[model samples]
Target chain A: MSENRPLILVTNDDGINAPGIRALIEVMNTLGDVMVVAPDSPQSGMGHAITINDTLYCNSINVIKDAPHKEYSCSGTPVDCVKIAVNEILKRKPDLCVSGINHGSNSSINVIYSGTMSAAVEAGTQGIPSIGFSLLDYSLEADFGPSKKFVKAIAQQTLKNGLPKGVVLNVNIPKLNASEINGIKICRQANAHWEEKFDKRTNPVGRDYYWLSGEFVNDDEGEDTDEWALRNGYVSVVPVQFDLTAYRAMDELNSWELK
Target chain B: MSENRPLILVTNDDGINAPGIRALIEVMNTLGDVMVVAPDSPQSGMGHAITINDTLYCNSINVIKDAPHKEYSCSGTPVDCVKIAVNEILKRKPDLCVSGINHGSNSSINVIYSGTMSAAVEAGTQGIPSIGFSLLDYSLEADFGPSKKFVKAIAQQTLKNGLPKGVVLNVNIPKLNASEINGIKICRQANAHWEEKFDKRTNPVGRDYYWLSGEFVNDDEGEDTDEWALRNGYVSVVPVQFDLTAYRAMDELNSWELK
Candidate 1:
């Protein structure tokens, strides 16, 4: 390995202007030549979706004044942004791809709904070492000071030693002061879910309408879960992969009669 | 279990008006008391997306004349429709929630990008037995006749023998005549991906734009994979679950030093 800097590609589900991505970009700048190709708008629950039905438009944007890194805002999903970056924008395959420093937690089952992690997963599918970072706070004005140093440390370690093949990291930082942060924990996604409740209403034209509302219910009491780590004020890092196969159940499923 | 028929919830990624769903509705009608709450428009690549950022609209529709099923057109993603149907529409947890008979194959990696599978996954999360059905063809005029009996059989089996907890089935029917089908094969999702190629172009004002394009590439040569089942003209049933944990890599990741 050369002593020279690594090439890092940074993107997020939150729009480029979101403070979360800005903080992530700042951290990446200290480690490598960073390229930013992120969505033009918030793409929060996009999962692994790509913009197959529309034309994509990407334009160079000047976000940080006098910063050497290049940035682009693309009219696509987070996964689309990664595809365009690797296949069209970037001149070479990046040494690493980091998505988010997102404004909300993607711990537990929420990872399935996350656009932030989807970007990282998309990179992993293309054989790039990647990590997606999220904070437990969802507010636009949420403080990111607690996460900066930890984010930098994780990114540096990942750059120094690449991740396992076909695996990406889903890191969720707790919302706390830097001094109060209880360090990092390698954890698994908790078995948690949103208990959905729809608020029903009638439109002005007498049509019934509803608004989706939910309460997060974490039933898993495992200490080695991302939810536990975040709840206890530690940054949680879960090694995630794109393969959806439940390998343990394969034999059982195969034994079932098809007729 | 009572001798009385089961109550089934039916939906699809394609809108309530799509011919593919209409055919599925017809097949499901013979099974039980079917209630359809599906999106009002096509949502092909919606993935596990939900309509959290917007208000939802669901109106009872009289789409199919003389059909003995309750149907509603929803202004939301497939996942959203499932949420609304379960939380607001249904009096109790459904015996079965079947999505699709979709116009395209959601076998292998396509499962991660499918709204149909998302609907089924959503139902599974709620402890409901669910399945997402798809055809190997993408034509709007594709025939569902060949796979109707198989689809009914699978749904009936799921209703009769409850799925092992926390699992949902992703069933893909090969596009072939009934007599030509080589029965069903319970399989695992193959290691497959789309080799993305962005179609670059210049707009009327000479700004560079792109259209996302790709070709499916199957890397797994295993005969027990979903890809192989489809290739051999057999219906592929992959038992899928939403827990995205890579358990084998957990220990290796835990060994990494965070400090």
Candidate 2:
């Protein structure tokens, strides 16, 4: 709504210091007045966790040298960063809120466990136009050059056209180089799951512990799915909503006739 | 799918020691071979979170004295409990997975931040029939007696006729006694949100910190909502799904025509 460049709030689950967020900050610097309020530590799978039982600490930081954007580091989850940014930090609600450029994919069922997408969803819940971006690669030094144009295009388009109510974009970029990329595809979330294979190990003190490991399984054969789009070398954009109600099944449930 | 007693996986975000899960366990014991796998500590706002970067420990515990049900206390989030229960503990997939009888409500927008509902959603993702139950009361000593019959009936119905794929239930019982309570109503999640007020305070060391405090704001006046049903003394049952995809927005997004 700004006559000047729109005020964009930038954040991520990989912490303010992560290269993923830095790449995002670089992109937003060209777009608008950016203010980043992100977690001080990596909060990869924190989901929609807030600092209820504990206290939150948000401190101003310089994530990039002579950065155009002002930044703050928060001592909470990605969702907490968005809450504190909206309620306490910013003087006004931001024109747009974009989370991530995350180190790993938040496609398909990963969106549920994603701290990145949760931040975006939190922003959407607060009635802000928001988007979450993630790369298929988990490497810290993954190539982000190919994603720059697409990311900016998406953000620019969102700013111009505006997002629908109760909806946010979950954009996942493939790891392919710029030349190998096949452009963006707006798609639905695939019916996929993580086949959890917990690595059970015994501690030196005789205590047994397990580390969560998993293999991504895309069971949905639909060509219109985010999984299919990502697999086919395109950046996948799936519009996500926070309303969990399964309206399609409500009639069936009503048929139960519970007393 | 068992020809004998159906296998039920019972879990809660309030940890294994909480009274809510105990009430849930008691109800499930009468209906099936109940196996309780819950968090070792309270994980109220851990929505869809799993322990990825850290280690998890799941230990057998006896919460109820002379209990018929088998229970395991997991050192992870509520979603982790479900993952561990399904993968590491149970020999076969559970017939039904029930999470919570939560001390507090998981109604409307609260479901997005709820660890209890996250467990149920996780089960739903794995193609299991799941339900998350909560009471409007937040007290540890709140009477769960009023909820027992309704909870049993719903669970019985779910067992008799399985939930559709990717669908789960979010059931919130009102605070009234059993006789005072009206019948269950299948409803939609109300468009509601918390009006967050962060209590900013200086720590003993003089640095500032904030505690998240909020009041539930129900702006939606729709009578068909869960909020309406709960406020009118009826138990609200909302069939929830894990498909976050906003299918309605796909066409508009496809029009973007990114280069």
Candidate 3:
């Protein structure tokens, strides 16, 4: 409720204690009053999932000692974290909501299965300026040192100039150092898909189980795509929308012979 | 994998035992060689979540005895079911994929948080012609008799015409008797969202917990929307696409002063 500073909400699919979120919190502290409410445990790949069938437990955490911003960890998905923050935790609507600084890339078709982008999109649906950040590295100890400046820059600019209505940004940084990065490029989501290759195993009880895994195939040869931007050593920023309607295909569907 | 019979894949957000999917199964059996792979437990509101962090158990279940179709129940989200079906179970890529005759509506804003539509979208990502169907009624005992004809009609059309690349269908039927209902309407997703209303409860141990619930709010008055079509007693079929890129906002985002 500070008059001088904007109220910024921070969350991520990675748990509150994750290094990626810690890096994000460090950047947001300079911008405004930050309220961090993220999952108590890692919630990667939980795309837009809410805790409807179960109870949620959210409590204050002392992740960083004497941190100016308050942080709460919840036992729910990323979308659940955002909903609870907006509905019950925050005194008023946040000026901006930022998610991720994810441990891995969420470019192209990965967005659909991304918990990071889903958190940002959920905030966007509530009419808040939002963005999701990710690094091409999927390691727990991924270098977030270089990402700080770009993250701060984008967040600062978003706070200064609001995002377009019904749109949120999906930003992906390359796995290179600050000097090697070609800088940010506003790009389109490349047409791609995950070629699923499940790892099947037999348990002690002689029953089979599967661990879901995949190979991301980016067939989109567009020079102006998120895949291209990231592969070419630039941070890719694709403005994402929640409206799923295929407006261009409505006319073709109308021609179907249905009664 | 007979050439004479089109290979159809059926799945739903509701468990394989639900009457809604049972209704869908009855209809699909008459169409092609149907392979039913769905969650063993109810997975409503699970969105596009995939089971990445945990092991998934999928087993053959005899839900409908000698029903002339194979049914495998998986302990995973809707998207996980689709992924497993395509990668581990199916002999070949499905000719078409159909999800749900969900016990509740997935119209308008519900599509984002809907496991039903997510299943269809997951299939669509792999180039399968897919559709998610739902009835306005949420009750477990809700009658699906009226929905059968329309479901068959739409599925048949999809198998014959095939969907546009990267597009799937989200169809919601009004909870009206067959005779009292109007015909199908090709529409766009209505702009709407859920107004969150969390119910806070104290546990016996004096710890606070919250149950996530919301009121569906649809303010979009456009007649070409799925909400409007459903309100007027028609089956609303919105051609939904997996591409979340906000093409219109790319230019505006490019204008941002972020380096």
Candidate 4:
């Protein structure tokens, strides 16, 4: 409730103690009063899932020693973190909300299945300026150092200029050093999807089980796409929306014969 | 795979034993050689979540004795069923995929949080023509008789004319009887959201936990919306897509001073 500074709500899908979030927190410390409400455990690929059928547990935590920001860990998905933060944790509406600096890429089609971006979209649904940041690297020791400046720049600019209603940013940083990064490019999500090939195996109990795996396929050759931007060593910023409606197809659907 | 009939994949967010999926199964059986792959447990509100961190169990189950279709119950989210069905269960790609005669409404913004629609979208992502159908009535005993004809018509139409890649239909039916139903309308998703209010309660150990509750708010007055169509006793069909990109906002985002 600082009068001079903006209140920023921070969250991520990689759990409260992930290195990606710590890097995000360090950058947000320079911007405003930050409140982090994240999952107690990693919630990757959870999409926009919420804890409707289950009870939610959210508690204050001090993960970072002497950290300036207030933090809470919740027993829920990334979207649940935002819902609880906005409804139960924060007293007043936050001026901004940012998710991730995620452990891996949320670029292109991954945005549909990303827990990191889902947190951001949830915040955006609640009428807050929100952004989700991700790196192309998937390793736990992935270099988040190069992402700091772009993260700060995007966050600062978002704070300065509010996002339009129903829209949030999905920013994917390429795995390049700060000097090598070719700045930010506002782009469209590339038309892409995972060609899922489930790894099927038999358990010790003689029962079949499946582990979901997939190869990323980007058939979109548009140079003005997130995939293209990331491939060219640029930080791609795609404005994403919660509305699933394909407005362009409405007319085509109307042409169908249905009495 | 018979050349005389189209192959159909039937799934639901509600468990395989739910009356909703059974009704969906009965309807799809009339359309083609149906393969029923649904969650063994109710997965309402699971969104586009996939079981990544956990093992998924799918087994052959005979919920409907001697039913003309092959059925399997999976211990996974609705999206997981689609992945497993396509990758491991089905010998060939399904000609059409239909998800849910869901026990509840997935109209408007609910489409984003719907496991039903997510299942259909997952199918769509895999290049299968798909549709997710729901009735406004959430009761287990809610009559799906009114929706059967419409559902058959829609599925038949989809099988005849394949859906554009990445797009699926999100169909919500009014609770009215088939005779009272006002037919179908191709509509846009209404601009609406859940005004969430968490119900806070203390456990036996005096630890506070919260249950999510929300009021559905539809402020959109557009008559061309799914909400308005459903409210007017019509079956509403909104063409939904997996691409989260806000194409219209790309130009405005491109104008941001990021470099």
Cα DockQ of the candidate 2 complex: 0.84
DockQ of each: 0.70, 0.84, 0.87, 0.82
- In model 2, the fraction of reference contacts reproduced equals 0.87
Report the alpha-carbon TM-score of model 3 versus the true structure.
0.99
Candidate 2 lDDT, B177-215, residue by residue in tens: 888888899999999888789999999999999999888
Show where candidate 1 strays beyond 4 Å. A1-3, B1-3
Write one digit per residue (lDDT tens) for candidate 2, span A43-123.
999999888899999899875578777999999999999999999988888999999999999999999999999999999
Point out the worst 10-residue segment of candidate 3 chain A by lDDT.
Answer: A250-259
For each candidate, what is chain B's TM-score? 0.97, 0.97, 0.98, 0.98
Each model's lDDT: 0.89, 0.92, 0.93, 0.90
Measured over the true interface residues after superposition, the C-alpha RMSD of each candidate is: 1.5, 1.0, 1.0, 1.1
Relative to the real complex, the DockQ score for model 3 comes to 0.87
* Candidate 4 i-RMS: 1.1
Candidate 4: stretches off by over 4 Å: none
Docking class of 4: high
Angstrom error of the Cα, residue A180, model 1: value is 1.3
Model 3 spans with C-alpha error above 4 angstroms: none
Give fnat of each prediction, in order.
Answer: 0.69, 0.87, 0.93, 0.85
